[model samples]
Target: MEVTTNTQVNERELWGGGAKPFSASYGKIMMWFFIVSDALTFTGFLVSYGFSRFKNINSWPIADEVFTHFPFLHGIDAPMYYVALMTFILIFSSVTMVLAVDAGHHMNKSKVTFYMLLTIIGGAIFVGSQAWEWKNFIKGEYGALETKGGQILQFVNLENDKRISIQDFAIGINSERKTHKSNIGLWYQNEKTLPKITVEEVKKGFLANPNLTIRTEQISENGQKTLLSRDEAIYKIDDATGVVEGANLIHNEYGNRLFADFFFFITGFHGFHVFSGVVINIIIFFNVILGTYEKRGHYEMVEKVGLYWHFVDLVWVFVFTFFYLV
Candidate 1:
């Protein structure tokens, strides 16, 4: 019967052992597997971050206020400008990768080489920019006081209702303080470097200056930090436990400690991926120059790396959305 014979042929074609599913090679299939797994991992992290932020919505740091620094534009308030530039650069690099893959398909070694180099350069710039941003974040701008209850107290000027740096108001009480090391301490505790200004000094300066008011981490109904009256500020400052100059695993001058934790983990993880991609791209760049793919009669390696680069770029879009915009 013709019908039975056609059914057998169809089964053979469908179940063939040598078949490439969806016309994809083994390498592409593996890359897709990796990308899918990685995407799930990123999703879990972002979900956790979302939940934590929701739980601490009142104390969460405002992304715009926190990430306002731009290189060579110190003391200027330019929110999200540098981050937008970084996103554009990364997306543009993805475009270059697409062109590189297309050139590889056509066996155009020169074009592939040019585009790969450009992608590498773009990736390098993004990584460098992220590092610079990290430096500024860790260094901090306006210092805050941490209470015994783990609350942050920032200072603002009543005249302009703007934040003022600790140096602007805090009176310098320079005293030599030694860092606690395991070898030097009886409790075997190791401590980080001391903050430039101490809590005692900030408290002293607060009492001396009448214009500076305390801004609590609690967000009011207007979605702004709660500004305490002069009487309340003086009452609140008495509960000061330490001076937090910047963010770390335990303390964050910005706001909630969890915000800094999620920020470092997410962005640092993404930065690692970008750095790895650049290194891989550089290797492929040399191969393109040396005609290794030409000898093999295929540039599948370039296409494979292009897939990875595209995945990295796509993940960053989600990261930028969650971390910056939201």
Candidate 2:
């Protein structure tokens, strides 16, 4: 007889008998595999974002300035406050999901239903808040002038040192302004909606206002935008090619265009995940009400969805740290 090898023994331990590896069922094992692969996908996205951000460290938009808006708190500078709240809501929803899973384990249908409802409510609020944030971001608060080199220049009041909106200072010129359509322009090209004011009008307004100064996109050592002197401001204003009113794939009044691109792609991807989770959670919630899992002698479905929910919440934590805090 031949001596037993380690590889043969390991194979026997793994597959020779009808034994559950790690005592996990087939569905649970498959879910873990899916989560591991999904985690790698998010990791790749965040790594790409980090590299791009480091490359444009000087000109990357400050999260505090960009995310200052809060619900029902117009004109207030609440930087990162609302984002913190959203994070709390999501984390709490994860907690409720855990409770739901625990109730499912004990076959407590009423408890599972209650916690599942809470989780769904929290997720819905988060999705709604994200939508509102996107609306504000797309409808940018302050407009800026973009140079041929794709640099953005904002305006500020020299006296009070407060940020100024292009709409607040841009003069209305009596000129025929029309959207560029494919019929009038290139057959395959169509221009985005034109800003209310043109660069020429903005130049005139800046020249007329002596108290206005220009703030470059470059971040200073003190973590503030570099403000130009009156003469320097006027000189830079001459280089203005177009007026950028909001964030889009092409232009961003905030700062670097790449920031907007990554923001849309990564956040939109995560938001889709949240929306899908909410829908699946609703389906599971109804199933719990109908006692489907109870008849099956186990609540493994709730546990599986709970795993996915926790993964989504965990991914958001890293995302928030990267996009908002960092």
Candidate 3:
């Protein structure tokens, strides 16, 4: 009995290497890899923002005062309300996406289609709302004076404690104030469009109105902007070198220019993600409608897109916490 024992095994008895690792397909694994890389990118951006904010802690703008506008509620002073609503919309969309994925798992094409449509609608509303917010931020509400050192000085009525717009108090001055056109100025040094009012006009107006006072960008321990006395307000107005009407890459009437820069970049990046997720969802939605996944006997595509949608919603929660709530 020449017994080679179990050492002489047949080739067919050896383990085959055709199975997927962790039972996940290549497409699903690729999506996860992309998400992890993108998350690291967002983390870098947020860390930079946090450091900048801490360095400029005194002059940073208050989120409540900056984002007070709401759709159809002009002059309501509803701080952070609209942002909260936008967050809700995005989270709700994530829920619908979950339903869609679950329906796909069960091979229920009709339910998947219905849930995907709901998710698309929710995303559209959120994107549109974000556009409106950007418009308001750029257009600005109450204008402010920018000091020589780039500090923002807002105006408020001492009697009513309400904000006062430059348009209401600035006295029109007849002078040689002209908009700098590209033809007249240096070819490479084109000026941004001039503000509706001038610094001198604002100064003159401030001197004339005893009831109006200046609010510095510095927040007090009481969580309010530092208000100056009548005399201090008038004295500060003399240092106003320019009038800032709205937010831009160069200037932000709200407060520090860096605040606006971070706001635009971080929020814009997240918005782009949401938009991309919406497009992906729509494509998957159509495929489901056409019985493509039904013929394949699985709805893993819907599950993958669902993961992306959920990630987008999760990122917004972090953004809302750092930018708005905190």
Taking all chains together, each candidate's TM-score versus the true structure is 0.91, 0.92, 0.92
Superposed by TM-score, candidate 3 places the C-alpha of residue 78 at a distance from the truth, in angstroms, of 0.9
Q: How high a TM-score does candidate 2 get?
A: 0.92
Better of 1 and 2 by lDDT: 2
Candidate 2 Cα lDDT to native: 0.91
Model 3: per-residue Cα lDDT over 249-308, one tens digit each = 889999999999999999999999999988998899899899999987789999999989
List candidate 2 stretches off by more than 4 Å: 1-17, 182-190
CA lDDT of 269 in candidate 1?
A: 91
Tell me the tens digit of each residue's lDDT in model 1 across 280-304.
9999999999999998778999999
lDDT of each: 0.91, 0.91, 0.89
Model 3 gets an lDDT of 0.89
Of candidate 3, the 10-residue stretch with the lowest lDDT total is: 6-15
Per-residue lDDT of 101 in model 1: 95
Window of ten residues with lowest summed lDDT in model 2: 7-16
lDDT of 3 at 91: 93
